[model samples]
Target: MRLFFKKRSTFKLFLKLTDWNNLLNSLTQNVIGIINSTKDSFTGDGVFENKERLGFLLKTAEEKEIKILDVGGVSTKPGFKEVRYEQELKRFNFFISNYFGKFKLSVDTMNYEIARHALENNFEIVNDVSGFNDLKMIQLIVEKAPKIILVHRHPNSSDIQEKMNYKDVVKEVRDHLEEKIENLISHGVDKSRISIDPGLGFGKSMEDSQKLFDNLEYFSFGFPLVVGYSKKKFAQNLEMTHEELYDHCIKSGVSLVRLHIAS
Candidate 1:
C-alpha cells in the first residue's frame, strides 16, 4: 500500500512502514479517520441517517489520504442509548464486507463477539475502549495476534456514559494503561503490538477529560499512544477550534489522533 503525505509550508512530512505487517507506527502521520456507523453520533456525522454521507466521508478521507479508519457502530457519548449486538453487527458488517481491503481497519468495540468477528475478517486493530476488562477479549487478541488499543476507562463503571471521579487524572489513567500493558505483555503479546488510548470523554467529566488531554504525554509508557478527542464536548468547551485541537495533538507527539470527517 502506498502512504501519502501532505506537504506543509514549514516542513515535509514523512512516514515509515513496518514491512507491511502493520499500518501504524510512531512515525505515521497523526490522523486516523473515524467512521461512526450509528445513527446518533454527537458530532452529527453518523452515516446511518443518510447513507450518502458515508460516500461523502469516504471521498473526504481519500482526499486527505487517511489510510487507517477507526469504525464504531454505537455511540459512546455520555447517556448514549444502548444498542443491541445484532444492530451493531449489521452496520459494522456492511462496512467490513464492502471495504475490507481498501484501507487498514480498526474495530472500535467493547464486545468480544464483535472483536472476534472483526479479527476473523482481517481487521488489523482491535480498539477496546473498555481496556479489555473482559477476559474473553484478551483471549481472542492472544489467539489472533492482532494489534490492540487499550483505552483508559474508569474501572468502577461498565457503561461509558457513567462519569467517575478521579483524584489525579494523569496518574490514575497512566496507572491503568501501565497495568493493562503489563497484562498484555505477560500474555505473550509483544510491546510493539499494543497501543494505549487515553479515552478522552468516556467515563470522564469534562474537567477531568481536559486535564487528561493537557497531560497526554504522561500516559505514554514506552508504547504508541492513541488519543481520541475529535468532536468531544470538552474540546469545544475550551474554545479551541478543531484545527487548533488537532494541532495540539500533533505537537504532543502522539502516535495517532482519531479524527472525524472534515466538515
Candidate 2:
C-alpha cells in the first residue's frame, strides 16, 4: 500500500486518535506495534534493513489493524552496538519515506536529533526510552509539541540495562515518572499529550520489574500508561501466562502496549 497522508489537521487528528478514556476503558486492548529498523533488536524482529521482511511485516501490521506503530532504528538492549546518527536517520527515513498507512507513527529513539527528524517528517509520537533526560530533547518537545512516551530508567546508570538497587521499585518508578511529567508541563507541554512507560528490563532486576508491573495502578496519576512488555525477561518468570498478564494489563488501565505482531 502507498503512503497516504490524510488531508486533515494533524493536531485535531491526534486528539481524535488518542481518545484516552475510550482507549483506557475499552475491552479491546490498543497496541503500539514494535518494528525495529536495525538488525540487532533484542527480539530479532528488525525489518527496515531487510526490504522483503519489512514489506511483509508492514502488510501484517495493516492486516492486523495496528493503529500505532513504534519504529526504532537503534537497539536499546545491553551490549547493542552504537549506531551513528546518520545511519539511524537513514534507517528511519527508509521506513518513513516508503510507508504511509492507516496507522499513526511513533519514533522510538533516545537521540534528540533523530527525534527532531522524525517529528519534522510527521511522526506522531516520540518514544524516548532515555526518560527525556536530555535538555535538548526536552527543548525539542517544547518546540514541536508531539505526543511522547516518557520511560523510567535508573538515575545512576547511563544505559537501559545497568541494574541499580532500589529501596522500593514501585515507589521509585512512580516518583521518577511524576518528576518527568512535571518537568514536561513546566516546559509548556500539555500533560494530556504525555504517556508513561515503567521501562521494564531497562534497569531493574526481574523481581523489581515484576513488582512494578503488579503495582501498575500506583502509577496511575491521571496520565495514561504505555507499556512495553513483549519478550521482557521478567515476564518469563511470572507465574501467570502471557495472555493472563496482558489481560491484567488492559484491566489495569494500560493505554497502550508496545507489542510484536504475533502478540
TM-scores for candidates 1 onward, in order: 0.87, 0.87
Name the TM-score of candidate 2: 0.87
Off by over 4 Å in 1: 1-22, 25-28
Could you give candidate 1's per-residue lDDT for residues 119-166 as a string of tens digits?
888788999887888888888888888888888877778676678888
RMSD of 1: 4.4
Whole-model Cα lDDT per candidate?
0.75, 0.77
Q: Which segments of candidate 2 are over 4 A away from where they belong?
A: 1-29
- How many clashes does each candidate structure show, in the order listed? 0, 2
**lDDT of predicted model 1:** 0.75
Best by TM-score: 2
